[model samples]
Target: MADHVRTVLGPVAPDALGRTSIHEHLLTLLDHVAYTPVETPEGRELGEQPVSLATRWYVRQQWVGVRDNLRLDSEAVATAEVARFRAAGGGAIADPTTDGIARDPAALARISRATGVHVVMGAGYYVHRSHPEWLEAASEEEIAERIVRDLQEGAAGTPVRAGFIGEVGCSWPMTDRERKSLRAAGRAQRATGAPLMVHPGRHPDAPAEIVRELDAVGADLSRTTIAHTERTLPSPAAIVELARTGVRPSIDCFGLETAYYPLAPFVRMPNDGGRLAIVEALLDAGLGERTLIAQDICQKHRLTAYGGHGYDHLIRDIPVMLEAAGRGDAVEQLLVANPAAWLAW
Candidate 1:
């Protein structure tokens, strides 16, 4: 690991991390989601539907209470949220809120102190949709300099170097600008010796190509993880190939079914099973040690009335699913061993 980076959880020596969710947004401002408009006419129409009085009242109450109380800028609230996670038995959480979306590093430090939970913060820029326009015009070397600065100098001037590289990639097809940004991100990773956590494109090949790109830039694949792979149902062979090459393939999406509530008019159940099937197949392929699971739960509404899925889900529900699948040890690997090793850098 580089001198600038420090794990908020202190030393994540082997077996020190217990129950970690590698991909999650602890406190997103919801600004990024706003940039990507609904493309289809029907989608836009649905989005514009007038809120029912009941729904309106609910939204208002949530906004007044939870949303207002949990703003990432508030150090006190961030500390409280970390306490909540610890109370629920979580040991560590990787907050992949990078660059523009990421908030104060001092706030993270305070939260770590208050809650006694290890927090690994991120250092790269976000995708094109979320990034500022100036970023798109910058040269790869310039972008790489910014990322390196974050890792070398603590983010927002905090003393801790960012513990990880991304949520760097985006969901859309890789554009020339995105490719340039990725190359820059890779260069930063190489310079800092920090692991890269990519937000792979929605396609399966996206991760494979990303790994290749990182390798070309001389980044260490053994320390990198391709995240949000839940949508990319890559073949088991392909997944194994990534693992063999030293990249950890993260299937982080777990409880996002609510996002598709009421379902699109054309979508159906069989397709819903696709994500779960990928999880099963990956486990069957013996990729358990290289896999990490998380809810990627970010929206303010997804958290309980008090706070987001809080922490009980990881301590309880996830273990139940693992047991049911006859892969109980796999859960330990993800929540404990894998993160410790990967984050140890």
Candidate 2:
């Protein structure tokens, strides 16, 4: 079959996917780790506190601990939120909420239908911690079969088939099962001829290590992407090094400007200017075609419904920033052409 972008609605032409976000979560539950006890003030249960203006500061600081800030369960809310993206001329979204992260393929389909935005769902396991206990006993072949099924058939018992093979989660000091998951993703990609994306651990070496893991399985590096490069690959040099492997490095943390990353305090997230600087570095290296970017709006606080920049932030805001930096011509390549080429398997 010719290369086409598989969407929840069905197969679409590559050029049809205009202004796409390569990584996002339309609906998910992080309660697997969010509700865990954290250091709170004097026996106060901060994890259970609902999201509000009063609690937004704490939620921003310790988002993983706040229950309300971690969940995106409302279909109505997702539809409304995505409507903003449609209004801003967004044509597609790749929601890579795979296994271990409460992926609702049915809900994604509904949101796509309501908003008229093409949504490409992901298939595979997430981080080792978010992984199910049954995964420990599962072999790579078994995992690969499941992923293949999701791509060719349907996901989560729904008729909505996954269009891609990841945001496959890997942690720093990759667990045995996580390594197995990467191998499984590689096999699944080989089987289905689908594009793959990976959520690398929060370490500098994590992206390169994952490159080795996938390469060992004979997967197509050019068809694979290393997601969250903004947080994983610290320096522009590190980002360039990973891109040399023929794997697209996705800097998918656009609107998240806080320097203190709650999950990894040691890692200082760059502001928008810093993100553009990295973009310049990639362009300078003649790797702009190999680069991808998104907002990666997984947290509830990152949604416009909750005082956060909606899906439109990238399309609506960033073009002007690029223009100010005298790189306005690259916007089409980054937001439309690159993603369309990558997503079209």
Candidate 3:
């Protein structure tokens, strides 16, 4: 009578989803979209130094460059990462790397098998910059059909189909093609009842714009997640307003404490404590059921293999923080039940 949560290991009852991390990237090529934080509303100068110098010194090393942000292809590494999550009592992970960003469904299936953790792959296009050569020429119907096929059939010739439509990347001022892709993703979500997780550009207001556009196309906001709100929607009130609209405001990006814009002229990254505070605020606002969290581990630097905080951050760190903040029950709803319900039909 109830919908199952489709995973790489096959569909399972929603209760079967234990502690779930609603967003992540187990594998990906760094070519999806070039994020220019300086161009964002949050961007600011590092100091008196010119932005060009800060851009050249820091941004180039951190976020840009294909080699630095190259594809994380080691199954052994992914296995180790997933193992940490599992050991920390993690139940499942949703990998939202779509077409443009280098999605490997078969490999994801292999990782799921290797680690025995449920994996959900994302379908649909990323930002227009890294889109396939034919995406611009393709009709919205054609794009939607491709994504639907990926969700229902298989992605990249693998029998393993995607369980979700996105972490569909969109910029602040949405592009024409980006809007088209969002609409197509909405069409696929309507067809599959799978959630659409979006990566709104690094601005607090970006989520509202994205929701407005997605709503215009008749998307089920309850089935949509506006991601990276830890950085985008700075205040709990801002996030609560978005969640009140019926869409989930995902407070992903845990343990990534490095100020993304290390220097002036780039948007900054908040620490984990700040994120926990926001979580407390959301719970206080009584929107705990409408929110979720994840690591958004996209780079080697974010992985344990590279001496970073692995998948255990949220599972290990947050519960203490949550209970200390007095919302212990909120953790279960955010990481487990909310993800299952959002991903299920």
Candidate 4:
């Protein structure tokens, strides 16, 4: 039965999932026009000098390549990325670039074939602001049916359906539209038995609200992951509480702290040690098995430069951090055994 919902790489073998980055993006070209280009006079006036120069150069290049290569060659790029990951002894990645911006499954299959990395795709709407207009009018049951169909059938006409439920439903203050989407997503999780992943809002109260909403809808907390909980300063007690209810807390937004900037470095989680400290605290509190970690690096420009960290960081750095902090065994449990048990693959 799981075959219907699994990717081309069915029942990912233990050996296959060498080191997984469970939440990341394979392709994204966010509406760059929504904000002024970094090079524009208005951007310059705002003192975003570095960004302005970068944006101007990016836009110029995009224009020049508009006719030749407007859209990203996702298959080729993903294949190459997977090759690099494999070379680094990495195994699997979950491309949580759900609807609106996610690339085609055919592309995913191509990359999987070329590079031998297990690629898990996602199904569900993005943030409320980015969602398609029709979703505003759709019924919860209708949304659930759509999500179930994607899990049961496949995304983008492939025989392989998506393996998970999100990167879904975000709003700074948990807006009505996002709430509706969350309810629908919960309904989908209930129907498909797929793990529901969330992109929680930036507010501190966001994690509690998300867990509450999912609980209210009869979603299996055990199978749910609150992704990027690292963004908000969630109380250690709050994280433990969620874990007590069987939900997994994830600090999946590694290495891309630059995206959150000034707000992130300051948003420490109640203790003195920063985000990593919080994970340690969660482990100490008896919820280590319910924790997961990843680097949610997205964006074409970032990957095109600097070799992009490749996805082997978890297998490489996690043990070192844990050992340095005197918790080596905990690292093995969290990074390896925990993810396997949670996904039930």
- Indicate which candidate wins on TM-score: 2
lDDT of 2 by residue, 60-87 (tens): 7677778778888889989998999999
Please list the C-alpha lDDT of all candidates, in the order they appear.
0.64, 0.88, 0.78, 0.66
Point out the higher-scoring one by TM-score: 1 or 3: 3
Q: Provide TM-scores for the models.
A: 0.79, 0.97, 0.88, 0.82
**If both were scored by TM-score, which would come out higher, candidate 2 or candidate 3?**
2
Error of 2 at 25 (Å): 0.5
Output the better candidate (2/3) by lDDT.
2
lDDT of candidate model 1 versus the reference: 0.64
Model 2 reaches what TM-score against the true structure?
Answer: 0.97
Q: With candidate 3 superimposed using the best TM-score fit, by how many Å does residue 199's alpha carbon deviate from the native? A: 1.1
lDDT of 3 by residue, 97-194 (tens): 88878888888888888888899889998876868888788888898899899888888888888888897878767788888888888878877777
By the lDDT metric, which is better: model 1 or model 2? 2
Error of 3 at 193 (Å): 1.5
Model 4 lDDT tens row, 1-345: 332225555556544465667786665544421233335565344332222334544433232122111223355675676677778666677777766754577777777888887778888887765676778898888877887887778776667778888877677788787888888889889876788898888787787788889889999888899887766645666666666767888877554433323223355423113557768878888888788887765544334332334456556666677788888878657665665565543
